[model samples]
Structure formats: C-alpha cells, structure tokens
Target: MSTVSRAPKRSLASRLPVVHQLQQSVGLQRGMLIAGLVVSGVFVLTAIFAPLIAPFGFAQRRDDAGIFGAQQPPSAEHLFGTTVGGYDVLSRVLWGAQTALFVIVVSVILSIFAGVLLGLVSGYFGGWLDRVLVVVCDAIYAFPSLLLAIVMSIVISGGQSSLVGGVFAAAISITVVFIPQYFRVIRAETVRIKAEAYVESAKVIGASSNRIMFRHVLRNATRTLPLIVTLNSSEAILTLAGLGFLGFGIEPTAAAEWGYDLNRALSDVTSGIWWTALYPGLAIVLVVLGITLVGESLNDLADPRLRGRRAVAQSAGVVAETSVVPGGSLTAGPGGLGGLEDGESFDEHGIETR
Candidate 1:
C-alpha cells in the first residue's frame, strides 16, 4: 500500500484576507505586497513601542547634563540632532508615529461603521432617504478633503489644539470626508446584490427584510470594503498631517505629531538646518507610500482586468489535455467522432463514445 502525505492546513492568521492575498500572489505582485507589509509593519511597531524605542520623552528638552542646546547637529548624544525647540528629533518622530496611528484608528473605525450602516440602509431601501443621502454625500464630495478637514478642525476645537481634542478633531473631520466614499461603494453594491436571484429567493421564502438585508446582502456587499479601508487609512494620515502643518494640530507637550514638527521646522529649513525637517518629512512620506502601495496592489489583484498572474511552465512528463488528435483531425478510418456533437462525448477510456 502506498501512503499519501497530507498538506498541512494554514493557521487562521495565514488564512486572513491580506495574508491569503500575499500567499497567492506571484512575482512582482508578491514583491510589492511584501515590501508594503514590511514598511507598514515597522511603522506600527514603532507606534506601539514608542515609549521604549525613543531615547527620551517627546517633550524632553533636557537630560542629566542640561537643556539640549537648540538646533544641535547630529552627535553621539542625539542621533538625529535636535529640533529648533531643542527637542530630540528622533524621539519626536517615534512618538509622532503613535499619534498618527491613533488618528488612523479613530478615523477609519468611525467612518467604516457610520458609512457602512448608512450605505446598507440607503441601498436596501431606495426611497426619499436614499436620495437625500446621495445628495448629501455628493455635496460633501464637492469640497476638497483638506479644506474640509481644516474647516472642521476649526469648528470642533475652536482653534485650540490639545492631545485628545486635536486627535479627535482630525479623526472626525477625516471621517466626514470618507463616509461618502464608503457609502457610495457599499450602496451601489447593495443595490446590485438586492436584485440577485438568491435575494429574490430569500424574499419569496418570506424572510424578514432585516434578515434578507443583513444575512444575505450585507455580507456579500462588504467584500470590496477592505480595499477602500486601506486606501482611506492612508488618506486619513495625510489629512492629519495637513491639519498639523496648518497649525491646528496637537501641542508638543500633549503629544508629538509629525505635521506639527514640520510646522516648527519651517524656519529651520531657511536657516540651513536640515535635520529638523528631514526625518519627520521622511516619516510621513514613507508611511503614506507603504499604505498606498498595499492599497494599489490589492486593488489591482482584485480586479480581473488588471491582475497579472505568473505564466505556468509545462513539464515534459505532464501531457496537456487536448481535443486534437496526433494528425490534427479526429477522423478515424471511415467513421469516427467528428469533433463531437452536442449529444456526443468521448468516454474516460479515450475510445468508447458516450
């Protein structure tokens, strides 16, 4: 008796959507996905462990010796040099990551929940509510996102910037802009799915409207959400940065923010002090690039028209299945299966007709 070895089952984590995509991707797709993940992962880890990784507190201006002299160049003591305010540039960057992460979580969560729910309701029940929502979303879309965010931040915080208040200001503002995007995507999907045969069947079986909507429609409608989520996360980061850069962001004492750092570093750039702006600017660029790459790769892979799969090589031992005979014609002697009619097919043995 011959024994066959069974392949090991993937763990739940490996079967996760992004992980599964990574595993299934080949060649250039795989490379892009992996690179994005690595960059994103480092940012997340830096945020999580900022307290430990950073050499000093975000607001620390002095060590055991004395106050770090303002605009100090990179030295053995301070790696990335000191900011114009005498803050350690490296520590500020690390803590800024945490602040950025918090904003991203807050914005994406609120937007997804509010947007998805509204979309489902609006799409399933096409009435005055749907039209009203569509119009509202279109109006919101008319404004530039950063401009809207700035207006919202002023309205929410009244020009006062603190840790919690500033973070929420940025989050809520970004959420408002993103809700329309999610709503439109989900609503369109729901409208299409509600007319599917299975949905009609469910209705015919006397299923409750809520059950039909949630049990059948909502789950299928959300398959496209992850791509949007990734893209929006990146957008949220940019919006937060914009808010801070525009002088409506968190204070240095309350929390570190890359945008605020850049704002503070503006004068430094003119004075030929490169260190203050370079690192924080790079942090923003890299995090955004990582997220954008992930979103774009997944978007391409999900669309059949754009997805590129590696070509498979044929092995000499594995003969391909084909309908063609050696002579390129199926005519056998005087009578044979002539390219098979609708009612005829060859049997498994490759001889008898069935």
Candidate 2:
C-alpha cells in the first residue's frame, strides 16, 4: 500500500488536455509571440550595442565626394542609403534606436511607478481621494495625449537641454496617460478581490488595512499586470514618437532620435529623398507592433476565460475518444464519463447494451 501510494504519476505536461480551448479562443502562440520577441530582441540588442555596431558616429557625415547621391537605394556600401543631408541613414537609424529605447525605459518606469502607487492608494482608500483622482484622470484623459505632450513641451522650452527636458516632459505626459488606466483597472480588480474569502479571512485574523490590501489583495489581483505593462510600454513609445514628430519631443540638436530625424526629413520628402522619413517611420511602426504583439500574447496567457475554454475543449475531446464501448453500448471510461448518447442502458454485467 505504501509503495502504491508513493508511485510516481505522469508529469503535469502529460496530463494536460491536448486541445487548449483558451488557446483556440485567444489564438495566441501561433508564432506571433516568437516573431514579436525575436524582432523586439534584435531592436533592443541593436540599441544596447549601438556604439559598437554602428559604422559611423551619430554626427558623422561624409564629404561631397564620398557622400554619394541623395535617396540612393539600399546597397552594399550604404545600407538604407544616404539621406539628403549626406548622413548615413542606417547608422542614424541604429543610433536612434538607443535614444528611442532610452526614452521608453525611463518614461515607462516612471509612469508605471506613479500609476501603480496612485492606483493602489485610490482603490484601497476610496472617498475624497478617489473622487479627486478620478476627476484629475478624467481631465487628463479628455485631452489628446499628443496635444498634452506639446503643451507640456512648450512650458519647458526655455533653452533647457533637449535630452533632459524631453525625457522629463515625456515621462510626465506618459504618466498622465497611464495613471487613469492603472487606477481604473486596479480599482475594479481590487473591488472584486477585496470581498473574496481569503481577504475576509485575513481581516478576521486582525490583519491591518495595509497588510490586507497590499499582501493579500494586490498580490492576487496582479496577474493582469504584465499585460498592462507591455501595453503601456507600447503606448509610451508611440507618444514619444508623436512628440518627436511634432518638434515638441527630443530637440533637433539631438542627432540620433528617430522622431527628430523624421521631423527634419519631412520637408525633404518632396525632393524624392524618401529614405529619411521611411526608415524612422518603419522603426517606430515595427517597435510598436512588437510591443503590441507581446501585450496581446500576455493577455491571452493570463485571461481565465480563454483558459476555461481550453479546459472544456480538452475535456470534451478526452470524453469523446474515451467513451467508446468495447462490445455494446457506449459508456464512460476511466476519465469519469459525463456525456451519454440517447437510449444507452447499463446491464447487470456492468456493460451497456443497446
């Protein structure tokens, strides 16, 4: 009896249902995740190793003789070709990744920290504080995020260093956009989880409000946070790019920014020097797409509705295959049969005969 009890069972992976219903519903992990991660990883690595990877410095330019013609198509010598101003477009694009990624990292960290703090506080201590935050978020949300960024940029445009000023401006504006989302999501989740049995039990055990909210409530409610973070990261990237395009983002003097480059090249678009705008635009689109895919995959993975669907499908399949009768009418197999066909009856021999 002891040996039988101690016998090793099949691994969890082997026991898992073959057809994942949630996977079907969400349609996740069908290569979007892999492709997104691979592309995003390449971009991140390029940004990290920009100094070593770029053949030319961000400010480097060739003289007339070596600069070649403007808007030249991609070639072995000048991949992505040279811009109208004789700058290496590929090198600039590579360097711009660093600037773009830097802003993304800083702004996302600040925004997430601020949003999460405000959300936690507002949700846990509802009343005047919640009302005030709601009002503030509503006001911010009313304005277009890009317009708000421009307004903030105007306020800070007093000969300040573009890098420092632009980062500060982007961080603040992105924080405003994100706080409302965080507050709303966290509040809803908190409200639902706060009344759960575990939370009530904790309260009954004399747990403080802070302990209950942070330890028990927040912990249980955070399964959706990774998806939120991924989505917000993409939003931050778009906002930053928009600010750059409007000339309110990283200053023109900052030579390696995709937004700044795009803005500079906008006028030259008429000269058929399309590479200038095209490269940066493509970079922005790819980065945003990658982030979006990652967020979508994470959401699919975390969503219980999808998981439950997958479970149902798997159970149904198992039942269908395992329900076959050996000689007579169909009956439930070892998997604990549920579904049964009409007119099926069990005889005293423990067999079903039509």
Best by TM-score: 1
Pick the lDDT winner.
1
Every candidate's CA RMSD: 8.3, 6.9
Looking at model 2, which ten-residue stretch has the lowest summed lDDT? 17-26
Per-residue lDDT of 176-227 in model 1, one digit per residue for the tens?
Answer: 9999998999899999999999999999999999999889999999998889
lDDT of each: 0.88, 0.73
Off by over 4 Å in 1: 1-13, 305-308, 311-354
Q: Backbone clashes in each candidate structure, one number apiece?
A: 0, 3
What is the TM-score (0 to 1) of candidate 1?
0.85
Candidate 2 lDDT over 75-95, as tens digits, reads: 887888777666678898898
